[model samples]
Target: ATGGRYVPRAILMDLEPGTMDSVRAGPFGQLFRPDNFVFGQSGAGNNWAKGHYTEGAELIDSVLDVVRKEAEGCDCLQGFQMCHSLGGGTGSGMGTLLISKVREEYPDRIMETFSVIPSPKVSDTVVEPYNAVLSFHQLVENADECFLLDNEALYDICFRTLKLTTPTYGDLNHLVSAAMSGVTTCLRFPGQLNCDLRKIAVNLVPFPRLH
Candidate 1:
């Protein structure tokens, strides 16, 4: 059904240079052009305020430029899908800011997010809970629908099912990607339900704030 129509024209942004290493050298590097990447030249340093206010503020205009360009290229832009982690400073703070900005520009478009929230059992940093709480507030206001993934639950799957002694970020990411692919199956394939993102949102989200 897709015939390459569903091949997303995406722009990836990261505050830290090291974080984008995989994107430049990974197996899927060919999927993206050099212009599709944006780097802030500095890290958020696990501080939500730094990400939201300083680095995010400085980089947002350039980010929006790319976003507008992509949207203009699309024949019929359905919506935006942002994937980020609520526990990390850049992913949480900058991600929240970006979604809000996107919402302001594209008021009628569906703003969906693949959010990875912090968990007590698999804690990474001390202030992860605080970052997540703050990020959640913005997501509630900006995002139309959120697909949340718990860090602890994913860890459990890696431990029990994959039998990995120490599961890497790549393993967890693969799991998340697999789940996303499953969710969007109806969008790309012929089916009885044949649901789009809006239809899925209609059925799943009974109330606007609940998502």
Candidate 2:
């Protein structure tokens, strides 16, 4: 674990070519290995169907290999957790594809997801609702539990609570990161109320589809 936190062995996948290089140069670059990054032919250009049927299928094997390796290294492999936006092509389409494949390959392992749903008032993509519906179906079918993050709610929190008149992407990301950290604090830090992923699912998800 890095800095007393369980730093996951991750395999970052994207549809845009050369996007991995920019990600690798970021602050979290040291957390990932060069081989753990996978990219498709090019950007999906907000085409969810293209990401799911074409690029997602093509890169399945490579992504699974990395997942298998990470699971093998774990002393007690518990489950999988995925984070993505439901309005984007790669994040929604490819993310759903990966979740389905993971469920197929590892039937016993639990899968949880943190999905960002687009705000109707602020969504940029015309087909975002279509992408969201498709991805939500896959999440219900494959993931054992899901945490929904609404863009409008988060935007409101930034504007009203945090007093950010014009919140940038970085500010929004920081908010999301903070929420994630708070939810996982029991797993990361030792305390009286020690909670695992299973417990989290039990408490948060009363019904699989509702989650």
Candidate 3:
């Protein structure tokens, strides 16, 4: 997933341990470092591993509206390059609903998504499997592309390459950030990418087939 044919960027909600100062920064930058993440114990017990979920539809919806407004506000922008969505639960589920509104708002602007599917270990749980398949399917219907990342396979790469002693939260976030950086660099650097937005839309494919 690190060395893909194209690169991508993100517009995340939070940034830099998230104090009051940096609310609603542009989609361009974030800490994206392992150190900034919060580690917590799940509600069931006080230790092992537990992932939490929220009914964040309203929040996601509002955020998408903000992004659409910003995209429209771009003075130099003739037309949008693409709208990116996430194929995962928060990204896909929340993302799908948001893009629909965006399409209504800006009919011709391109919308794309960079989402990850759950790994078998994570997918063994009911929530991830359900979210991944259902959300991803919906995303494929509307988004320009769903660049899939298998957490399991990616983690294996991190462990092997980074030589992490324990696959701690820090290690995991680093891997995710690195992969994102790789994508961003590839697409934005000109000539580095084998394909661009035109190729993807015209052919409906990820060309250059970087694997």
Q: In candidate 1, what are the lDDT values of residues 1-211, reduced to their tens digit?
A: 1445334487899998775777778877756756768889887888888889999889989999999998998888889989999888899989999998999999999998999999988888999999999999999899989999997899899999999999988899899999999878988898756367787788889888999
For TM-score, candidate 2 versus 3, the one ahead is 2
TM for candidate 3 is 0.58
What's the count of clashing pairs in each model shown? 0, 0, 9
Report every candidate's CA lDDT.
Answer: 0.87, 0.84, 0.46
Clashing pairs in 1: none
Q: Which candidate, 1 or 2, has the higher lDDT?
A: 1
Order of all candidates by TM-score, from best down to worst?
1, 2, 3
Q: Is candidate 2 or candidate 3 better by lDDT?
A: 2
After superposition, candidate 2 runs with Cα above 4 Å error: 1-8, 192-194
**Candidate RMSDs in order:** 2.7, 2.5, 9.3
